[model samples]
Target: MEEKMNSGLVTSSRKKLTIVDTDVHHGYRAQSDLYPYLTKFNAERFAEWGFGGLSTHLYTSSGGLHGQRVDFDAGEAGDGLGTIGDAHYCSTRLLDANGIDLAVLTGGIAGAASALPDVDYGSALCRAFNDHSMEHWIAKDPRFRLNLDINSQDPLGAAAEIDRLGSHPAVCGVMFSCGAPKPFGQRFYHPIYEACARHGLAVTMHFGSEGEGVNPPPSAAGFPSYYIESRQLRPPAYAVHLASFIFEGVFEKFPTLKVAMVESGFAWVAPLIWKMDLDWKGLRRHTPWVKRLPSEYLVDHFRFGTQPLDEPADPEAIKHIINWIGGSRTLMFASDFPHWDADDPMMTLSDQPEDLRRRIFAENAIETYKLSLPAISQAA
Candidate 1:
């Protein structure tokens, strides 16, 4: 079945899926349209930061961060490694185009998700990006929602934006990238977490380059010189974010704050949380401010996306992650969609245990992102 919109468009009626993409990088694809709103500093900084052989077509000039273009054939339109162009891609090309339902819009831009300046400039750009998404991409469709990517530099500025933007009917939550110089445990991001708790907006952290704007040679770690080493570093960022919240007492401060660690593989979560619990049990004397075990804090406060699945991802492995992280409820499913690395959405879900099918596919994401179905009757 299909439903008709006020705009005279028809979309899929399937309601079992609600994709809340946490690691999107589409901003690089739309940079030309967004550049006019960026400050002169953003443009100048972007060029100055380019290293040899990495001449970029998309990036803010101020920090040479928050932007990178995707490559695709002219005929592909917004179809790149992992992007679908605009609302059409979400509704038509992918979901309706594939018999799926509901989509939560997030950025595919690196810089937008990075620790750019502070939350002030970061928040302004976020508003601009959301405005652009709603007007040009979502086209006011209630089903296609947005999440604000906040700068970790200034948590207060981020908090202010979350208060302002979270109230906007179109926004679903706030996003925090993990690679900032400030380790996640610092007090720098508390205000943003506080704001999210107040507004009831979910907080998201995606896995990727921290956009430190610096490159590391493989020899530093004695790892082989290959592009994969760069990618391996992505998952560690999540641990940093988790450690920040757990050790810093952010969760204790705002118990209701909902946080989701996206794009990072779920496999490591179980072991990491175990290690965290052990560390906290012994290290509590070191940081007397923390009132509980870090593992207990994570099980209560965090959620992880299940994608970039381990090769030979056995049912036992999936089950083990669930058990380690506390339960099946903490695992949410995602395709990572148009990115070259995205796992096949269908294959990922199909492999799950029968009892876990519904919760992982959509139910958990709805709770994590705080999105309601709009009551089918209400949609009409």
Candidate 2:
């Protein structure tokens, strides 16, 4: 689908601000596109088992479109599907059309790879996906950056993958889908974080894999009957991970580490931070290693993507939330492109002050991802 923004809405001082989309999902037009990247052993194994796209089960609530925008041409379903054509179609349709300066490609490998029971197989799948993305997506467009997916089941392998690809000029960060075997801050995953810090790359945790494959149920109360219910679980899931990262002193261990919570809305963040600060005041003795209030770490080391921007009846409420969360620095723009719920850059958060809008749209992302911007023709 072609996504164009209303040019008037994005102009700041009569200049269209460059946009940095932190969470664009570049999908495989077909499963077979990855075969050439997969090892001979794994390729044969996949053939026997049948290709499992990113998720283990179909998103029953996607209403047959699987959460993709109905207008998106997924190309035909045959050999050489996405590889043959439309591979860079999204880049032209969305980024170029909308004046996006840089987009981080969060591919669909993390969930499926993390869900595999065989750790070796999961690692192999991750490697293949990274290789495929490098050749087909990042190499095709200098504007597209990568968030290399890793298999959390094998942290060593995940770290090795990061070390191997972290230096690529277009690789910006490391990504893990929300559903993992354990909380991200656990010692088991420290090596992954260590590698990210070493490479000066940020870590992005996107919402995916909940209740699918080997992931536990979507919510603590148990699985919900409808998709809306599952959607509600996303914020809390991010909250849990954030709390885990804070209380466990992950930030203290790697002070330079930056974490971006993609697709999870930011409205709930202020309240959660307030509560954490309140409890920490009384419970500081338990986790003495945490040097400051929980919220302080978040402000310094974490960023929230602004895709599912909260829409309150009063527009002022959105501004209030942004201020409470530390202004423009705490949020970054993410299109979640090609997905059914993707936000329009010109439309989402349009009411914010121009300075804040510019920061969210570009500056915050560049700083968070440590991006080196390339020259592009300015929007007239």
What C-alpha lDDT do the candidate models reach, one value each? 0.58, 0.79
Tens digit per residue, CA lDDT, model 1, 1-380: 33532223334433344444443433334445555555676544334442222322221231111111232222334522344555554454444433344566556433333444333554555555555665665554556657775655666666776776678765667766555666665676677777887778887777533443332221336333444555576566677667877787787778887777777777777778778778877777988878877777776778887767665445566556666776567877665655546554556656556667667766777777776664332232
**Residue 79 error, candidate 2, Å:** 11
For model 1, what is the error of residue 203's alpha carbon versus the real structure, in angstroms, after optimal superposition? 1.3
lDDT per residue for candidate 2 within 249-333, as digits (tens), equals 9999999999999988899999999999999999999999998999899899889998787899987888899999995788999
* lDDT of candidate 1 at residue 1, scale 0 to 100: 36
Name model 1 segments beyond 4 Å from true. Answer: 1-29, 35-82, 108-123, 214-224, 313-315, 375-380
Global Cα lDDT for candidate 2: 0.79
- How many residue pairs clash (N, CA or C atoms closer than 3 angstroms) in each of the candidate models, in the order given? 25, 0
